[model samples]
Target: MTGSVPVHLEVDRGAVLDGDLVLPPEPRGVVAFAHGSGSSRHSPRNRAVARVLQEAGLGTLLFDLLTEDEERTDAVTAELRFDVPFLAGRLVAAVDRLGARPDTAGAPLGLFGASTGAAAALTAAAERPDAVRAVVSRGGRPDLAGQALGRVRPPVLLIVGGLDTEVLRLNEQAADALSAPCTLRVVPGAGHLFEEPGTLAEAATSARDFFLSTVPGPIGT
Candidate 1:
């Protein structure tokens, strides 16, 4: 595909996830997005970043980490969203699924995570270091990843809003724990959501540049 295509991924134990996959021709790499908190594939911020990646000749997979029923339950209990291990497992499944697909097989893989999803992305990258080449987090809670942060082998780019001080500090601490090459970027005048006028664009551009430089380009390109 050229446009966003709907996909169903069977992650774990018959738990299927809905997603939208957008691929550019001869993409340099494929990025799997993990939305934070209770957010799903429809998150406008993640979708915006995905579009930027697609425009830059990278494929993007935006998927839900939880099932509909689980979402309903999480809405009330607020449990599943914070379970980093569970979310990371689902993300690893998605990564493996993408690796096995004909269109994305052999492509350099990356993860783009937001909020708590960032922690899950780091944990998943640690589990699949041989497969994941790069990682990028936007206003993420990488500290929540805990011990797994030290195991991530791929280069990491953690983007934080300048105004989101607590999260920025957490990312700083997470960076100190990472042995892999890691860069912490701050988008000035932006809050946790990057809702400011041009901050999200800056973060998106930084992500694009990082993936382009770190994730290996297409073979023979």
Candidate 2:
């Protein structure tokens, strides 16, 4: 695998988000991460999954959804983190930015989202039907996407912790609303955070396999 580098993405003209971009040699596809509420690109769990994908020859982009100032405000008011539409717009912009980059332009695009970020990923996939090839949500709140769930065209994988009952039910509801192919898998003994022994590794492996199968490319090319 090639070295990963820090990147500053301008999702809007003046709005920048911090990210880390990792490209493997002859990567087959790229997966962009949408972290949950109160999380950033630095999330250790997402980072761990990103490492697995990179080793498998899939490029990964882990970016913050909110600007530094916005995060601070949301910390106090707890409002903007749940704004699905707003977060979706940012995700779409990030996808566009990835497509525009020479190193990643030819690779198929996928999204991996966690928590409320899963809703944003679903909404963005619905918005850009042709751009996103696949989506995977880890312990996510996909039901928060509302009507947008029906519009998504890419195959989706919803990974829920077996112990996270409420979220599992929500994922099932969201799956029923989807028009595209969708699957829900539960990691036994895992909680919302997948903190149980070996559960997170299992989740990451599932995500890697799903993207590899759904994205049209020669793996490790």
For 1-221, candidate 1 gives per-residue lDDT tens digits of 49888999998878999999988778899999999997999999999998888889889999999999999999999999999999999999999999888888888899999999999999999999999999999999999999998899999999999999999998999999998899999999999999999999999999999999988687333
* TM-scores, one per candidate: 0.97, 0.97
lDDT of 1: 0.93
The pairs that clash in candidate 1 are none
Q: How accurate is candidate 2 locally (lDDT)?
A: 0.93
- Per-model RMSD to reference: 1.2, 1.7
How good is model 1 by TM-score?
A: 0.97
lDDT on C-alpha atoms for all candidate structures: 0.93, 0.93
lDDT of 2 at 177: 96
Candidate number with greatest TM-score: 1
